[model samples]
Target: MKFYNFMTSQDSSVQLVDQAVLLFTLGEEKEAESLLVEYLSRHENDLSAWRALSEIRLSTKDFSAAEHACRKALSINPDDLTSNVSLARILVSQGDKEGAEEASSKARVLGWKDELAQDEHNG
Candidate 1:
């Protein structure tokens, strides 16, 4: 139930996500989720906001909402590694083992390529 560390930062999306993060950390999941829904109204395409909201939903055992947020994030950037991982996790939470495994496999392939590219750059 620990608050996310970056919630206090004065970033543009901070206001949209901070209250929910704090409420969730304090175990007020229902209150936090209300705030998340409100945030989504104005910042539907904010990836960071979506990620925070998704994390809170997952913590509260709301797999469907988490999956929705994750999908929104993926729509913004299909190759986003974090969103891929989050979607996989949400799929697992929903007992969609095949979907989760597919996402995990994709993530692994992308991560491996990214690491190789980084190695080439460093070499």
Candidate 2:
């Protein structure tokens, strides 16, 4: 039987996460998520680490994971807009208007005006 090569040339999850961030910033969110997931398997519970993963999940419409990642980020920082927006947007997408509104209000009150604007504009 032929053996498959699952090993990546670069084994650094942090590096993969960095690449994911760059890709996401460039509007390649789906591709970023693909890379981030691999990184998350190697490094769990890292704030920046989770933030990147959460963003990837959010961009790819994986609301559940996005929420989870946002919660994880909140666990690290109660006022993390990056993750909050991700979670709030996911809630909005899932038709949880109340939840989304609540999150949006919190974000607005918590100095996340940018997030609030994005939500309002999209909503």
Candidate 3:
């Protein structure tokens, strides 16, 4: 895994996320989660951190927490395709088929929009 240069004069929030990613890669999920929680406490509007937290919770089978984190990320940016997909997975794990389908559809539409935007930019 690629590690960020912590010695560089980067933003503290970025450094914190880099550390959390390192911990997560080392299989120190609880430590990573704690770091992410700390980061979120200071940066509640950070969508990427919310998404990472959601993924960690999902890996731990904490479906409700995963959904909550996913929702938080979605609230920050409702058009985020990855968060919508994560929400779908979390809902599916919790046996909420309808919610999962809705999330899935949202993700699909977002993906299509992204592709169209890319095509427009390239073509």
Candidate 4:
């Protein structure tokens, strides 16, 4: 596979994932989501891709799908602070305050103290 100087060398180095993020940034949400879904099909264990998928779904108010993606990321790495926080937010949106708090508390304990909103919004 041809390498791009911009894309980091990693197991999840699917050009489609970067393209999806670009599409999303360009306000082409549908195309971005399509690309992400395609990328996920082959790179199911990619934490970054899962996180992006969850964020995109969340933006579209697809709570269930977002939660599923978040859970997928968590399954890959339960200690993923971002996924924990995302799961917390998804749970809160689904009116599961208890679950949300639990997830949030776990994220807190995991030392993910940074504000997630800025990065999440960009995604």
Candidate 5:
């Protein structure tokens, strides 16, 4: 993946997320998590980074941490479909069926809106 494409900000610190993703892909979960934690410390409001961290935690079976990270992402952008979906997944993993359902519903609504927006843009 192109690091530049994923970056929403010009700050050099964002590159850490790209590196962390690469490390995660290489099976270095601990290192990747460490980097993500470090990056988040400086850029707490980065939605993508929080989502990425949530994914890493989810993959590691750290459901609580994943939920926390996903919630952080949602706090930054409540309309983010991806974060809502992630939250649903985390909740499901933790056996919170009602919460998962709520999150899933939110994601579906956001996804519908996104599709509508895309169609509008294209049409």
Candidate 6:
């Protein structure tokens, strides 16, 4: 098993996530996944890390891992629209219509709530 210290400060972890994203965009998904998994090992509450990990798994066609990662994200924040949408996508591809609809509904509700909150803030 690969071992590394996992007590990084939030700012440093965020920077790592950004760097991982750059790696991902450059078609270095293996490296990106390694970095993200490292980040999540300690900062498991990190929303972005979970979302990015889910994306990486999905892109790699690891459907079960993608669903698990997406569900993990949702467990951390049940109202996370991105995670819910991702779960919907994964479920749809797996032929789980009911599961997909539930996740889609969650995303829709979260999206509308966020949009309303933004509108209120702007007004």
Q: Write the per-residue lDDT of candidate 5 for residues 29-77, one digit (tens) a residue.
A: 9999998898789889988889889999999999999999999998999
Candidate 3 lDDT score relative to the true structure: 0.90
lDDT of each: 0.83, 0.76, 0.90, 0.85, 0.90, 0.89
Greater TM-score among 1 and 6 belongs to 6
Task: Point out the worst 10-residue segment of candidate 3 by lDDT.
Answer: 4-13
Give the residue spans of candidate 2 off by over 4 A.
1-16, 24-31, 112-123
What 10-residue stretch in candidate 6 is worst by lDDT? 5-14
lDDT ranking, high to low: 5, 3, 6, 4, 1, 2
Question: Per-residue alpha-carbon lDDT of model 1 for 62-100, expressed as tens digits?
Answer: 899889988888888888788888889989999999999
Worst 10 residues of 5 by lDDT: 4-13
Better of 2 and 4 by TM-score: 4
Q: What's the TM-score of every candidate structure?
A: 0.78, 0.63, 0.88, 0.78, 0.89, 0.87
Clashing pairs in 3: none
lDDT of 2 by residue, 31-79 (tens): 8877766666766656777888776777677888888877888798877
Please identify model 3 stretches exceeding 4 Å from their true place.
1-10
Instruction: Give the RMSD in angstroms, all C-alphas superposed, for model 4.
Output: 6.9
Whole-structure CA lDDT of model 1: 0.83
Name the best candidate (by TM-score): 5
Question: Compared with the true structure, what per-residue lDDT tens digits does model 6 show for residues 28-50?
Answer: 99999999998788888888888
Steric overlap count per candidate:
0, 0, 0, 0, 0, 0
**TM-score rank order:** 5, 3, 6, 4, 1, 2
Pairs that collide in candidate 1 are none
Q: RMSD per prediction, one decimal?
A: 6.8, 10.1, 5.1, 6.9, 5.0, 5.5
